[model samples]
Target: MQADVETPDYLRDAKAAGIGGDERWSIVDHVAANPRAGDLIVGSGGARKIRFAAPGRGKSGGYRVVTYYGEDDLPVFLLNVFKKGDRVNLSKAEINALREELSHLAREYRQGVMRYVKGR
Candidate 1:
């Protein structure tokens, strides 16, 4: 089954990082095809980090996408996107904050599903 794709507000700011429209589409398509693809970033609340090649650019000069796929039933959450080398690895404190925020996000998403089903 193809997982639903979702780009959060932060990810939508890809333009700021030189991620063009076509490149974004490619990233979305690739993630949808391979939902579990990417290296799991430990302590980031289940976020998977993937390297994506920009149009005409190899992976060395591509982008990084941080995503969260909470469950098979849920949509793939594009957490953040950035150009390579723009930032170093996240610190422990950053990961801790992200973990908490992601946990809250997942809870809200799941609750929304339940509410929808109950209403139906």
Candidate 2:
């Protein structure tokens, strides 16, 4: 099934990383086609990290995207993105914070969806 991709922070991060439109769409398409394409990030509350090749750069020098696929009911959330050289790994504190944030996001999203469905 085609997955829905929500870029909550991806646009800003991609712009900051100098990622162009084509590249951005490529990433979204790939993720939508295979939401579980990335590896699971330990202690990230189900967040996954996927590496994408930049236009001319190989995967080694590409961008790393942080995504969360909490469940099939929720859209795949593009939480963060950064160049490989910018950040290699998240610190313990960072991981904990991400876990909490993701939890909140998932809860909020579900509530919002439920409200919408009821209103409809």
Candidate 3:
């Protein structure tokens, strides 16, 4: 089954990164087609970064999509994105922060699902 998707505020506000409505949908479609397409960052709260070619740009000029798929049961969270040269690598400190936040996000999401299921 295709996993549900979630986009965090940072990514949603990346207008400077050139992410438009079409680009966003393209990303959603890409991940929905292949949820495991991205390479897992060794550490970053299970986050993965995937490359996406823009409409006229090739892979070299593509954008990087940072996402987190905690498990089979959880939705794929689109955490952030940036152009290829916008940033190089995430720092250890950033990853550590993600670890803490994503943990809480997962727990809350699970609880929300359970409540919905039970309420139904």
Q: Lowest summed lDDT over 10 consecutive residues: which window, candidate 3?
A: 4-13
Q: Against the true structure, whose lDDT is highest?
A: 2
> What's the lDDT for residue 109 in model 3?
88
Candidate 3 lDDT over 9-115, as tens digits, reads 54664576877888787788887767777888777767888988867888678788878777778777777777787675577897888888887988998998899
Better of 2 and 3 by TM-score: 2
For model 2, residues 59-106, the per-residue Cα lDDT tens digits are 889999988888778788888899998987777897899999987987
Worst 10 residues of 2 by lDDT: 1-10
lDDT of 2 at 32: 82
Per-residue error (Å), model 2, residue 86: 1.3
Clashes in candidate 3: how many?
0
CA deviation > 4 Å runs, candidate 1: 117-120
Q: Please give each candidate's TM-score.
A: 0.84, 0.90, 0.84
The lDDT, on a scale of 0 to 1, for candidate 2 is 0.85
Stretches of candidate 2 off by over 4 Å are none
Output the number of the TM-score-best candidate: 2
- Evaluate residue 94 in candidate 2 and report its C-alpha lDDT on the 0 to 100 scale: 76
